[model samples]
Target chain A: MFLREFWHKLGSPKWFYQISTGWMIGFAVAALVLLVVGMVWGLAFAPADYQQGNSFRIIYVHVPTAMVAQSVYISMGVAGIVLFVWRMKLADVAIAACLPVGMMLTALALFSGGVWGRPTWGTWWEWDGRTVSTLVLLFLYIGIYALREAIPDITLRGRASALVAIVGTINIPIIKYSVDWWHTLHQPGSFSLTEKPTMPVEMWAPLLVMVLGMYCFAGYIILARMRIEILLREQRTQWVRGLVA
Target chain B: MILRLFFSELRLLSRNKAQVLNPLAFLFLGVMLFSVGVPSTVQSNGIYAGAVLWFIVLLTNLLALDGLFRRDYDNGVLEQILCASEIPFMVILMRIFVHWLHTGLLITLLAPLLGLALGIEAHALPVVMLALLLGTPALSFIGATGAALTVGFSRGGVLLALLVLPLFLPVLIFGANVINDAVAGIDNTAQLYWLAFISMVAFTIGPFATTVGLKISVQLQ
Candidate 1:
């Protein structure tokens, strides 16, 4: 009865599958609204950087995507921890779901950062702290995806890849602080513990909007992917048979 | 018990000449390819050698050690080793030791040619060798962890590199730092000592984590 009770409550794939679509719609609508508004405001209307000119506008995309990349890693790490801690099928599903979403954000970060660099730094690429370390971040994502796809056994692959993601958290501070640590050409953190951000709220407001939008998009994708995973995993269950009928 | 387990691994390593040779050759071939791949400009002559050497070593470590646990896992001997009460932990420790003995030693011994291929000067030979000596054990120990984690998979070598290469960053950084010291005409005794310190730390802590991974792989089967 406890198993049945738990199944009726949290344990059932059918229940999760049923509830997720609602979450996905709410987040998807919110993400679209925020992302569109943020992009229009930042790219067209925001005041230009005194130093960087119009190229500074790229920050709305770069900052949001970079923040999303790192946080998606945390998201994946939590999914991994859940996978191991509870041995939940949905947790594993969540992990596999989030990997690509994390990767897309990493690509966006790298692309926008490179584009931003051209007008500001006068180079196509630089091995400065942020670029090099972010390159390593890209490698970590690729490695996780490649490792999972390359492996045959589902759960072993999941566990092994999770360990990789967890270890990669070590790189987060290194990525953020590599400039300060190495004295590289890249600028130091905009927001400092010892001091406030260099720019006013008018400058950072659009960034906040875009960052929240990216997070919602990330959440929407994970929920959507989890729905597919539940369906595939529960194909043989009675709930699926009833729903299909 | 540890000695017997270690030596048995040594014997197994000695006997499997192809497995041993593939990675050793890869370490050499990878370095050679890099030298030829990059134009032989003046800028390429000095510190570049160390960077290339460390990169090749990381790649070789991945290709070589990817199968570290898979073969034992597939053979089902890992299950026996796990269920065996004589020394479950030591057995896992033995496996790691053997992995190091093969790939790590191979990298150190082969470094001179790789250094030469990369246009390293003769004066820097001792520095490069010493740096490899200082850093390769950590590669083996860390590589063993990656290998153990990925062993149950079908296509693991690339994934192994992905998982293992990030862990190898400090080694690559400090390893390159030591060799760069020589090229820049800086004294590197302190750097080499620091690398040795990190290698010792990796050696001590890496095996237990590897044992956990190995035990899980065996259980899954």
Candidate 2:
């Protein structure tokens, strides 16, 4: 019953707007504190890799952004399903809110990956599986962003983008595996659930901090953007007018 | 009903000879351009030929995709069909089938000639044709979804490419690799199976998505 009530409340933009302020502030503070601690520890204090040395520190940013970028796409796909199946207006808003952030994160991940590559791999880019798949993920984000921009109607735009997101989500695994089969030069992932970390505790700990911080950062940004979008989309509603007044 | 839709689509496409011929011409010219531009030393290898042929086929498929629904949508036939047809799914599926028949199948048939011109060995030529035969249906189906989504827009050409091209990657990867493996005598059955699998997935998902896209587009009108 409590879960059902919360679900119904989640459907209300006014309820969401009223309640999310606390979350937005909490996430913002957590993000700033965690990011500062992670960056300082990882960048300045953490011992460098024996092989790549300082160059490997880029992982502090690269791994987290790449991880979050893919996660954001999956979340958007989930939001797309919610929007389609339940006709949740907030779900569409979540998708719209997630796009620019997801795109930027994907771009950042790619850029950071490239920067890391130049030092370690001795080239700025390689057509390896992970790199190409990440690049494709970026393209998927941009395509959805462009699709949303092209459609003028809000309802149609939401549905169309939702469909594309769902399709992309289905394709993502196929793309990753196919590309992996085609070629692979990038190293196997450093972190996995089944295996222990190859790196020492000092290295993985700050990395963990960075990853958590990035998620908090994303949550904060997405929530803030969703709030602004809700206001713009619901400007004519009495609650919105009341809030504005 | 399916046969009727198929024949009418065939008749309609037969009347527009250019619609049937343009992608073929584009495919031919695209191969020709690649052959002219690349050095002979590079073009001599089967890997290069396989990659070039698959790339051109992908482009040719994209070239034909916009026409998949735009004409019908513009003429109000799409609206009428959606409103009146008992099975719009079959109608849409038939339209995509006819589209694949004209564009993808023609390209597959023409690939051998293009493969030879690009210097694929006689032995590898069959694999080129076979891989394209397995692969192009997926391209047509997936591209049809993008085309359906953007059918309402007048200047959807570039946007359509951006939307559809990334989705084409797996088909392009596996399709090209099949030919490369065949050329190298690597027993390419694995890649062929992958191509077939991707095509099946696309076939299952493509029409349903395209139907939804068409509905959303038609309602916009």
Candidate 3:
């Protein structure tokens, strides 16, 4: 019964706004402190790699962003499922809030990956499995964004985008596997995931911190964006007008 | 009922000769332009033929997609069908079938000519044609899903391409590989099997997705 009450309260935008504002502030501070500390430790304190030297330090940013990008997509897929199944407006807002941030993180991952690649592989881009799959993920995000912009109706847009998000989620594994297979067939000596990272704990500890920090940052951004969306969507409501006034 | 719908759809498309002729003409011109644009002497015959033909077929498939629903949509026939039909998926499946018979099947039949123009070996011609025949149904089905999704848009051509083409990549890869393998004197059966598998998957999912998209389109209207 309490869970049901909580679920009912969640459907109320004013309740969500009142509660989420506090969480948002707390998340923002945590993300900021964690990010600053992680960057300082990883950039200044970690020892240089034996192979790629300081150039390998970009992994701290790249891997975390890549992980966050993938996580955001999975979250959107779950939200999509929720939106359609439960008819939840909050889930739609969640998807709307996730796209811009997800696209940015995916782009950052690609850019940082490219920077990491230039020194190690002598090329700015490599058609390996991870790079190709991430590139496809970027395209999927663009497709969703473009589709939403093209549709004018609010409900239809949400439903259509939900369908697309679910489809993209299903395709992610297929895309990853196909690219992996294609890479293996043509390029034998491509990157390997099975080989464990040889980095010392001194190096990886800060990398772990950065990954956690990025995820917290994602949470903060998602909540902040959701609050704004809820306000804009419910602007006609008395509570929203009262808050604005 | 499904067979009748399929035949009527075919007949309706046939009456508008441009619907039948334009995509084929587009394929012919695309093949000519692509072959002329590339310096054909450098690349091997198999590589050039396989890549160019697959891309042209894919583009032709894309071009044919919007027509699947646009006419019925503009005529209000789609709304009528929705209200009248017990199973809209069957109606959608029939439409896709007629579309493939006209555009995709015709492309497969005429692929040999395209192959000859691209200097594909006669031995490899059958493989290319077979690959296309097995592969284009899935292409049509996939395109139907995109068309259904974007049917309500005034300017959906570019958006449909963006939405559909990435999804079409696996089909293109497998389709082209068969002919390339044949050219390399390797057994092409594995590629054909993959093509068949993808086509089966598309057939299962495509009509269902198109039905959902159409229902959404109807709601928006």
Best candidate according to DockQ = 2
The interface root-mean-square deviation of each model, in the order shown, is 3.3, 0.7, 1.3
What local lDDT score does residue A18 receive in model 3, on the 0 to 100 scale? 99
* By lDDT: ranked, best first: 2, 3, 1
lDDT of 3 by residue, B67-166 (tens): 8899889888898888898888888899899889888899999988999988788888888889999999888987888899899887889988888887
DockQ of 3: 0.53
Q: Which candidate tops lDDT?
A: 2
CAPRI quality level assigned to candidate 3 from its DockQ score? medium
Q: Where does candidate 2 stray beyond 4 Å?
A: B41-45
Show where candidate 3 strays beyond 4 Å: A1-9, A184-204, B187-190
lDDT of 2 at A235: 96
Docking class of 2: medium
lDDT of 2 by residue, A1-245 (tens): 99999988999999999999999999999999999999999999999999999998999999999999999999999999999898999999999999999999999999999999999999999888999999999999999999999888999999999999988999999999999989898777878999999889999999999999999999999999999999999999999999968
lDDT by candidate, in order shown: 0.77, 0.91, 0.84
Q: Candidate 3 chain A vs. true chain A: TM-score? A: 0.92
Measured with C-alpha atoms, the lDDT of residue B196 in candidate 2 is 89
